[model samples]
Target chain A: MARNRVGVIGGGQLARMMIPPAVELGIDLRVLEEAEGMSADLAATGVGDYRDLDTVLAFAETVDVVTFDHEHVPPAILRELVGRGIPVHPGPDALLYAQDKLQMRAKLSELGLPVPDWAAVESADELGVFLADHGGRAVVKTARGGYDGKGVRVVTEASGADDWFLALAEDGHGGALLVEELVDFRRELAQLVARRPSGEVAAWPVVETVQRDGVCAEVIAPAPGAAGRVAQASADIARRVAEGLGVTGVLAVELFETTDDRVLINELAMRPHNSGHWSIEGAVTGQFEQHLRAVLDLPLGSTAPREDWSVMVNILGGPAEGTLQDRYPAALAAHPEAKFHGYGKAPRPGRKVGHVTVGGDDLDDVVYRARAAAAFFEG
Target chain B: MARNRVGVIGGGQLARMMIPPAVELGIDLRVLEEAEGMSADLAATGVGDYRDLDTVLAFAETVDVVTFDHEHVPPAILRELVGRGIPVHPGPDALLYAQDKLQMRAKLSELGLPVPDWAAVESADELGVFLADHGGRAVVKTARGGYDGKGVRVVTEASGADDWFLALAEDGHGGALLVEELVDFRRELAQLVARRPSGEVAAWPVVETVQRDGVCAEVIAPAPGAAGRVAQASADIARRVAEGLGVTGVLAVELFETTDDRVLINELAMRPHNSGHWSIEGAVTGQFEQHLRAVLDLPLGSTAPREDWSVMVNILGGPAEGTLQDRYPAALAAHPEAKFHGYGKAPRPGRKVGHVTVGGDDLDDVVYRARAAAAFFEG
Candidate 1:
């Protein structure tokens, strides 16, 4: 039997992580990268814009299935690929929900799933009315092209929404805005699920992710005391979302665990998310391999944790005065249990260059060791 | 602090495994390969004969420490490098034991370690007496350049030794023959230990390795039902052997576990061994990284098992009739708990292509799943 070739649209760490499993499975992987020296640098063949139909089509022609590293690909290009008989995992229709928050919110609300009390707003008057009806403060965001902390703003007064409304109007997105009543949630959590084309789905344990400066700094799997009803609820919700939305690959549901013990859908990502990085060493089957299997329409695998507790800490690039190895011996000597993974990239301030994972029965100890090891590299 | 540069003498999978940790530690790695398209094909900077001093010296000049992927480097070349003040881990004096079986047997016997009774013979008359004393059967082996069932033969009849003795006499190897009592052993086990330049040592759990056609098929760490005393004894013996022989870096002591519950020394490898591959995912610190730390005079990490059991199965090349990915979905679908690793090599019958590791609490389940997954790839 011939191996299926997979074409990834971007060449970030997600794409790089995919290479190991792809190579293990003997799959020919070709990445359409936007930059040289990116992760997945060795396997990348086509260097072009993901939004270009011709480049994507040419790249798709050499592979059996088309997947993505990021959700930035234009919907039209994905639609065109699907129209041309190409099997695109998380096809254009599903990706639209991730790309446009308004559409996703509408669909989730219709499905009777819990979401923030949100309203579609076109002007500052509408935003003010929604805020007045709920609370004095509201979280306002552009419906499309927002990531990290960009394109998001908190408004307390009517005049505070003027700049965002004016900007959206200038971009011909007058009606593309979503305002939600900021909830008093306790913490952030993420539930990851992988769904195959055959409708089989698998969900990993819900994890608590600690964010620093809007980037994930650490993740604790099974989220300490989250095994009973919370785990079941999170997994059930993630599986329902995957099946309900027809998501054919890995779906990471960013969730909010409210004080009242409820999980509200915060956002959705259709590829491997940073929150699941711990699974590479902590789970029975890693999310990267599961993603590939799901996208290829293969049977889904178990997402059980290998240990009682697993912690993942991201290594954010720090000051450029020192090299990574400068702290290697120290970290290895200090925390012998830490499993380090360094991406072959030059360090720059605030860049995500690597991560460390530690697993054991003691959750706090593993988390502490993982964070300390990661800090050694980042600092 | 400057990064330590390591020069490896071979470009097989052992050298390939070193790359990931070297990259993580920011160590500059240079490999002297004999062929192109070897496992460490990308990291190797110079390709040359291990017997050539000039080529070895040139490669040494680019790195801070010298190591080997295999015990094939000529003793003369190693001596030459040592004469030039280049630090060679498992230096010439220590490497001789691993390079020659006769010397190894003599040294182990001198150290009061149990070993098969053996002697060097010249003629069929000498072999006849030796075989007659050992139930009319003896194992004859060349003193050097033997591996994987090659260069060794079992002789049952006195006449069968005549041709070998004649060939030895003709080649001035009259005294280079070995005659040994063929013991009935139950199974083979390997004890892996790493020693640093500073004399610090660490040992992994002794593992039972299953062989097929004289090649390793699988490895089960802590050797099921192996008494704690026996496991510790094996590790202690290996550590003592390493320290006594002034061996640095990782050393694998292969032993024969007899039906009488006696452990006899079989062979020794002074580098990362296939039996320790499970450490990459199953141990706190992988053998490759620990080996690097040891040779570089850095502190070694703990060798605790991350899981209760770890079973590793080799993916031998079966036939070149199908692509590896053809078995990917099936293997993964059937055993999602198995973690697959493949060396990017073109498949050929009986070739050491890659391996899969299944690690968890249930030993029986892990071993069964791992073996089945490996069989799929091999088939």
Candidate 2:
């Protein structure tokens, strides 16, 4: 008879989307938001720094389980919650792979997963050897605190990353740099899966994701022309990663389809990722709702597709010509079937403000409508 | 661009359900909730009396348009808002029919809509004459403040309603009683429609609703065995009512399938109704979202069914054995495809706390799953 309260750290759009489903499932969701007027402020939000042990511990004490909106929280903080016997989903051990690139690459390779050729580089000399061993060019990235094209660079020469190596050496953060062979992929795809503490797993149809400048812009469900074998392989890879890492919530595995038709893992997100936003309107049970059920250790819902095709287009901040409300009339009239989702956030250029999803029997029509609807909000 | 602010009065489950759609449409929805910790307290809620002109006017001044979660707000208060030039959806001119049954009967008759044989009675003598002209039996009802099964009676003789007639005469509220011939109908049906001020209207497929003690217990979308002619008739009747009344939001028309194979109007509601709750998971767009679009004069979304069948069963409060969260695991495990919606209210016997909807290719299977899932929460 006691309430099943789930505490979420880092209030963002992900936490906001979880509210409806959490209400439906009769779960009391309390959020530890970063500040006043954050995306999920509609719920019982506590303003505090997620990295502070006392702040997180206070938030953790109020709920039956603890989860997160992002992976930015340090592993030490998460371990502290575990040390207090608070149930933390995607425990610090599993989340470390998402937070640190070098750890993810080493761990995935140890498990024999298909990852691009990669290595840890502590100095300009190490970067030179890794680049030369591949194609004389590599993508170098910081091990942690990098997102949306930040803390990343393409280096053809060792000196290109000499400044980063020096900064890492000065900071004294061991295992700070990692490099990977620049991949020539034909397209990008994503596999979404949810796992529970009981070890039950559910995988949704693999979707094709489009990126512009390292930010996800669009997604097409049940990737067009993707062979059945390819879909099966993608699901298998995501399932293996979720189970092997002991992930107890939603996991997103970004993949690349090389020109030779091989699927290789690109990156990993341990929470509800942007790639699965289309599922909110296209799937039988949306990824947000599934995340709540999984974190609570309840039975997972079906991940079956509700339509033959579904397309999602992100609404990024544009020239600030108008607010989203100004475009609702035209956008809604243009595509009556498009479902628009706006995060209650102030718009900033190139920032993700909302998304539009359209599903139907035809792929092209759905994609066109979704794109057109999103365009209105951008302008 | 300026934000579109919608002010809603009388916070309840209907307002609670509207929150998701309002958020999606990028509109700032502020609710004048009746009390703290009400169903829609999670939204931007202001506590006040909806009946007080000053309280209502103060709330009205902050929004662009005004609507209601219930129709109990006095017409004078609505007229006062209109006097101030604030757009009130289902304005006083139209909401009168929903507040008074006698007025609704007279108006529907004038519009040539099919309603039962009825007449107003000021005293027991008039009731006797009406009953004698009929089959020696009639149904009596108060003109206002009636809901569910309250303020209604089946009287076979004049003396059976003597007390009510005497009270009506003494109160000085003239013609407080109306009598209609007892209707012999085969079943009940409901038609849901949304209309914008631009004269655009969208109607969902007619549904059959089951009632227990005048409370809606279940609903079946695209009602099985309903002839095409009957479905069209229901939609036409509902559309005519919406247009004729100048309704600016969702309208629900409860009807009776007479033994002579005809649809007759039974009741009218000017806002989201229980019979259309199935649309939340069954149709391309839900009644809540459609209502927002209509009130905003935005283009309405498609009302096409997402599947061949959808069944919704209300979770009426039974013996309060446990909280809804305690039953979620068993219910979700048993029916993974069923979508549950809880109103976040304390459960009491016969009160509507939540509902479960299931959509699929098979009617019997969907119905079974829906009923079973609802039953789990009831106990």
Please report the candidate that would top TM-score against the real structure: 2
Going through the candidates in order, what is the number of backbone clashes in each? Answer: 0, 0
Q: Is the docking of candidate 2 incorrect, acceptable, medium or high quality?
A: medium
Let me know the DockQ for model 1: 0.43
Q: Itemize residue pairs with steric clashes in candidate 1.
A: none
User: What is the per-residue lDDT of model 1 for residues A209-263, given as tens digits with 9 covering 90 to 100?
Assistant: 8888777888999887788888888888898888778898899998889998988
**DockQ values of all predictions:** 0.43, 0.70
Candidate 1 lDDT, B1-379, residue by residue in tens: 6457888999888887787667555466778888886877756788888888888899998888999999989899999888988899989999999888888878888888778888877777788888889998888887777877776789997676677667768887465577788877899999999998888899998999998877888999878887586797788789878987889999999888888888877778899998999998788778998988888877788899878899999988853666566667777778877777767677898888889888878888888888888888865
Q: lDDT tens string, model 2, B284-320?
A: 8999999888887888998998889999999899438
Which pairs of residues collide in candidate 2?
none
| Best-fitting candidate, scored by DockQ | 2
The fraction of correct interface contacts reproduced by each prediction comes to 0.47, 0.76
Candidate 2 chain A minimal-lDDT segment of 10 residues: A318-327
